[model samples]
Target: MSPERFARINQMLDNRQIDLTVCLDKVHKTNNIAAVIRSADCVGIHQIHAVWPDIDMRVSGNTASGSQQWVKTIKHYRFEEAEQAFNAQNMQILTTTFSDTAVDYRDIDYTKPTAIVMGNERDGTSPEAIAAASQHILIPMIGMVQSLNVSVAAALVMYEAQRQRQLANMYGTRKLDHAYCQTMLFEQGHPVYAKACRRKQIPYPSIDEQGQIVASTEWWQRMRAPDPQALTC
Candidate 1:
């Protein structure tokens, strides 16, 4: 990796928000899925949760615009499973819905660990999601169209969180796990070698401050050796 590229990756990693995330509740549209991910990436979200009961539903690579490379998506087959995962992370789940108890999206304190749950394009949030949410949020719309697109609503909510976090000086610092940061640095800074290591079933090597690989001679020999399974390909 060049020094400039390494610096850029380090800067991005430093700004990553480990505690902020989004949850999709049965959002089946490919465009919407991709848009949400792209927006999440722009706002420094490291990961997002998605519930896909229908296995056929997936994000379109073309629509994702390479955002998937930076923003990881964790798939869940059930709503309850996603909820449990959020609870384990100690995130306050906020569902976007219109109810008597629902408050403005801007009212919540985004400085804390938060997970905003968005519903499907048509049916809106599921009953279980609404019931499980720690708080319900709504974006006030005075116009005739009382609703906005799912992705649009999510972007608004995410930006609100970002704005609050920025005011609190939450950016420009590394909050991700040390091991995870090292793995990302290696995979992103030296993608070619990372791919080779995976295909050859070799463990990743440590990267030095100068962005050079630091591995033993034995490891180098294994890396240069021909793949025993190459003939199968």
Candidate 2:
């Protein structure tokens, strides 16, 4: 598939049907953060919650190719806020760390709502984040190094999620809410695709139709018809 095709599919996934998040905790390196964002998008994750004290955005902006615009990034300054948000949603917070209770990273189930947290490159997950996590994961290794960089570790974990959820055919036909999807694609300036979507009864998106970056399902509904066969016949 071409880059444009990939971008379209990514926009589709951002409709929030994927149910996974990647968050960084006060990570110092911008290149690594940028790479993490890139990796998250590469693997079909379109929402990222990042918590960093001071970020050198040049690193992320350089690699993102405006890819971040296609994704929703909620920035946080405190671990408590990040923890409270994901935890309240019952999202399984899995952190990469080599602690006594840490399990092999491959053991965790990624099919459920999940948030993978990566901590400071030098310090690993903060004590607070580790405590808040539902489980601690470690990438097992037989090599000379015991740990990988923060960004590399995140890539490995998220791909593991893709492997499990995908091998099970978890997302192929997963349909998001019809209305929410249309608004998203429409706002993406995909009027043609939006018409196709409404004609097919696909989900309408929830984007703010009048906002700066806008997409509206109402436009599609105005031009398209509900499936006739879906009616009482």
Q: Evaluated with lDDT, which candidate comes out highest? A: 1
What is candidate 2's TM-score against the reference? 0.71
Q: What is the C-alpha lDDT of each candidate?
A: 0.92, 0.73
> Which 10 consecutive positions of candidate 2 have the poorest summed lDDT?
206-215
lDDT over C-alpha atoms for residue 216 of model 1 = 99
- The best candidate by TM-score is 1
Residue-wise C-alpha lDDT for candidate 2, range 1-233, written one tens digit per residue:
23564456545554333578888888878788788878777777757887865543334688666667556677887888888889777899998788898998899999888999898878888888888889998998999997899888899998899888778676655355555454454545555655565666665444433322233666456446655655655
| Local accuracy of candidate 1 as per-residue lDDT tens digits, 71-106 | 999998898998998899899999999999999999
